[model samples]
Target: MLSPKLEVVITPNRIAVRNVGSGATATADAPFSCSHLLADDIDILEHAAQGAMKQVVGGGFLPSYPIVEVSTGGRPLHQVERKVIRDALANAGASKVHFAPSVTDVDEQADARAAYIAAAKRRR
Candidate 1:
């Protein structure tokens, strides 16, 4: 069976996570601004992402690493900023990470994931 798929949305002050397979969702709010570019501290963003991941995954017996798709709310990230986000998701147990275009609705995110999966299969 394929591992679970996860979607993450990063905003300036909140991290939203959803399990695409299970429909479980979680939201983590940062005490301070969590923006990678505007915030004085970047760790807040990482921490919030970690927290949200944990909330979504819960205590289930995960068979494999979950695939993660992240959206930065339409903001473009620098290479370093992207690395930081990817590292945070990896730390939270994601095996493969993908960045999606700015998506807000759940259906839009799912469509993006489907397109990515299809493209990946073609490349293989």
Candidate 2:
């Protein structure tokens, strides 16, 4: 078994990565602050997050701070979501975990309403 090669792509507001020779990519918004660190073998994701933060801060997209504040675009890891994460981390042998809070997208309601309207129109 070998580690996959990762290709990092940094944008002004986004940070993304691709596994070399694979279609798998992971991305997150930039300028994130570290809320917690998990003491486990999940350092890959943590390192990627740090890299994205560095790019954004280094590029002057956001001010430099001791902690990188990442914006997760409103979807918070709570409720059922939190449960799913806890299960995954536990399964992965994570001894510790971190949680960062982000504002929920206010547009989710509007999006839902729009989808409902569209569906109604389609039915009509």
lDDT of each: 0.71, 0.39
Please provide, for model 1 over 1-124, each residue's C-alpha lDDT reduced to its tens digit, 9 standing for 90 to 100: 3567899887677779999877889998885354345223456766776677667676643445789999877766656566767776777678888989563223436688899999999999
TM-score of each: 0.66, 0.26
| TM-score of model 1 vs. true structure | 0.66
Identify the runs in model 2 with alpha carbons over 4 angstroms from their true place: 32-124
Candidate 2's TM-score reads 0.26
Clashing pairs in 2: 31-69, 32-68, 32-69, 32-70, 33-68, 33-69, 33-70
lDDT of 2 by residue, 1-124 (tens): 1333334433333445444444455566533223331212233444545454334334433232222222334444334434433343333223333344542323436788899999999998
Q: Pick by lDDT: which candidate is best?
A: 1
Candidate 2: 10-residue stretch with minimal lDDT = 61-70
Clashes of each: 0, 7
